[model samples]
Target: MLWFILIPVLVILLILLISCICIVPQATAYVVEWLGVYQATWPAGLKFKVPFLMRVAKKVSLKEQVVDFKPQPVITRDNVTMQIDTVVFFQVTDAKLFTYGVERPMAAIENLTATTLRNIIGDMELDHTLTSRDIINTKITAILDQATDKWGIKVNRVEVKNIIPPAEIQDAMEKQMKAERQRRESILRAEGEKRSAILVAEGEKESAILRADAVREQRIREAQGEAQAIMEVQTALADSIKLLNEAAPTDKVLAIKSLEALAKVADGKATKLIIPSDMQNLAGMVASIKEMVTDDSAKK
Candidate 1:
């Protein structure tokens, strides 16, 4: 009977001892309540609790968490209706406050986010709302961070996931975009044609310049050739005159050469010839040459 009693008591004590041991995992916190009231928060690692007196109330995760809310209907200042969805990033900073600060923390946060979004949207026009996502996000994060301080929640960031305008507005926006694209295309085509025309004009101008240069060069070459021919003729005439002087020609021989030149000039189609003032003297010399020739022929 004693052995049975001891074994039952020992088993009961062992069960109680095992129940007192609390091992909290990393990035976790356990909110403890002493006799149904707030007591202490247990961090990660080994912990001991008073048997049957302290109870684990709430387990709070210290890691950052993401919550995506459904799209909420909002009205812009312009009276345009739109649906906007949001995602909130948060982290539990104080385990005790997270457990006891708010009745339903997640529901509270969702409701707060919807209300904040509506207020922000109500102050902005549809166009402004659509274009100002960053401004909206910053404003909401600031408000939520301030509001949720007591709940031991740190609002890390808020994102406006989607903003949907009405179907009619969407259709109008699409048409506007299409028209803008067409205008840009027309402008680009005109610019391309303008550039092409400019290139053609430049090419023609360059071709004209090259042709002018070639013609000018040909004329210069022809003039140079004519000048060289004239110089060569003058040089030959000078050499002939020098040779004649070296040979020491008599006046009769010179007069015979001049008469021969005059006869050649008279053979041309000219109607008249200008005779030199010394022509009479030249005629007398020529007659003398003719007599010498006749005498030489007789002597031979």
Candidate 2:
């Protein structure tokens, strides 16, 4: 009966001891509270707590986390209403502060983000808001980081996910863009036509110049050929005159040769002729020969 009573007590003690021991995992933190008051933060590995006196209040993750907030209505400086949503990346730095700093930290961050975004957009026009996304993101991240410092939440980055302008404004922008693209296309087409015309004109001008050069060359060749022919004729004439001088012809032979040259000139298409004084005498002598031939025929 004594052994049975001791065995039951040993088993109960063992159960209690196992329940009091806590093992914190990696990238995790445990906030311990003693008698409902803040005590110590337990890190990874084996940890011990006073039995029935201390408890794990909250388990905080040290890893980075992301929160995507819904779209909120905002008005720009130009009084243009638009809807914008954001995403925030954060990590827990101090587990104790994170546990006790604020109630509902995620909700607090969302509200703060919406208010800050409105303030920023209120100072800018619609055009600036649409174009300066990086500037807006940086400004919001800086503000949130400073505000959440006491809460042990480090805001690493903030991003504007989407911005939806009014439907009318979007349609107008699209039409304007279309017109601008058409204008650019027209200008490019006009430039291309102008360049083509210039090329054709240049080609025609070059062709004209080449044709003129070819004509000039042909005329020059013809003139040179004519001059060569004249030179050859003059040389042949000179050779003939030299042979005649060497032959030493008598005056009668010279007169006969002159008569032959006069006969050749008379055969031409010319209507006028100038007779030499010696030619008249030669003609009279030819007429006497004709009369002598006639008298001899009669006598025969």
Candidate 3:
């Protein structure tokens, strides 16, 4: 009778022990509850639980999670409506808070994200909201982190997935951008042309200066040559005058030279040789003197 009762009690205890020992998966934690109230959160690996009184109420994943938000239409401060979509990357930093702090942490996080986006977009113009995406993402992350910190949630990052403007607004923006690019191109071309003109003008000015210098140098050399020629002529004229002054003023040399000049004129290859009127008297006197000398020699 004792053996039968003992075996039944041992089997019941073994079943209860099996149920109490729980194997939690890696990167996962379980929330324990006693009497349907929050008790404790068990980390991953082997854990124990009260067979029926205390059970694993919930299993909270500690791994990182990605939540993508649907597109939400927001009105900008400039009265333009924009459709924006975003994604939030987060992880359960505190398993205890994740299980009890909020009713649905994912839903709460998504709602907070949408509200924050609307608030941020509402303060800015549509153009700013669309263009400054990085700035908007940073702002959202900062605000979300601060807000969720009390709930033991850490917001890793927030990203603006897309900012879609209305069709008409998109068309207008494209046209405006095209016009701006064209204007910039025109300004750049004009600037390049202006620089080229300035360079050409400067080159011309430098060439003109060089040409003037060359001409001046040429004129200076030409003037130097002319002055040298004039000096040579003046020097020759002075030397001739000096020789004439040094010559003997005697009648013999003059008479000899006069005879020589007369003979050269008489033998000249010309039909007529005109003498100066003043030399006519010298010629007659010379003839008379030569005739007397001839007569005296004949008498001797």
Candidate 4:
């Protein structure tokens, strides 16, 4: 009977001991509450709590987290309505403050983000809002970081995810883009045509220069050929005169040769003939002819 009673009590104690001990994981924190009031925050590793009076109020993760909020309709300063969504990156700094400072922290953050975004967009015009996303994100992050400091949340960065304008505005933007692209294409084509014309003009100029050079060279070659022919004829005549002088022919022999040249000239169909005064002696001409005939007959 005593052993049975001791065993039951020992098992109950073991169960209580196990229930009182808590093991916190890495990058995790446990907020403890005693008697429905905040007590202490337990960090990673082993922790002990008084059973039946102390309990973990909340488990906070210390890692950075991202939250993407839904799109909210906002009116710009120019009274243009647009939808904008945002994303927030944050980390828990103090586990105790995070647990007790705010109720439903994620929902509170979402509401805060929407309100802050509306205020920022309301101060800017539609065109500015569309173009200044980075500026808006920086402003929002600074505001949120300051506001959430007491809640033990650090706002690392904020991003504007998407912005949607009216359908009429989108159509107008597309038409403007198309006109701009066409203008650029026209300018490029004109530049290309101008470059092509320049190249053609240069090529024609070069061809004209080459043709002029060729013509000049051909004329020079023809003149040189004519000059060489004249020189050759003069040299042949000089050689014939030299051979005749070396033969030492008498005056009568010279007169015979001159007569032969005159006879060749008279063979042409000329209307007139002029004779030299020396050939006016008919008897001498006849005697020379008879002598020429006698010598020819003797040789035969």
Backbone clashes for every candidate come to: 0, 0, 0, 0
Encode model 1's per-residue lDDT on 80-101: one tens digit a residue: 9999999999999999988889
Where does the lowest 10-residue lDDT sum fall in candidate 1?
Answer: 277-286
Query: How does each model score on TM-score?
Result: 0.75, 0.63, 0.56, 0.66
> Candidate 1, 25: how far from true, in Å?
4.8
**Which sequence of candidate numbers ranks them by lDDT, best first?**
1, 2, 4, 3
Please, what is the whole-model Cα lDDT of each candidate in the order they appear?
0.95, 0.94, 0.87, 0.93
Q: List the residue pairs that clash in candidate 2.
A: none
- Give candidate 3's TM-score: 0.56
Identify the leading candidate in terms of lDDT. Answer: 1
Ranking of all predicted structures according to TM-score, beginning with the best and ending with the worst: 1, 4, 2, 3
In terms of lDDT, model 3 sits at: 0.87
Q: Is candidate 1 or candidate 2 better by TM-score?
A: 1
Question: After aligning candidate 3 to the native by TM-score, how far in Å is the CA of 55 from where it should be?
Answer: 1.2
Candidate 1 stretches greater than 4 Å from native: 1-27, 33-36, 44-56, 232-278, 281-300
**Residue 76, candidate 4: how far off, in angstroms?**
1.0
Q: Give the top-scoring candidate (TM-score).
A: 1
- Per-residue lDDT tens digits for candidate 3, residues 84-199, read 99999888877777777898888899889999999999999976887899999999999999888767688999999988898999999899999999999999999999999999
TM-score, predicted candidate 2 vs. hidden true structure? 0.63
Q: 2 or 4: which has the higher lDDT?
A: 2
Off by over 4 Å in 3: 1-13, 176-300
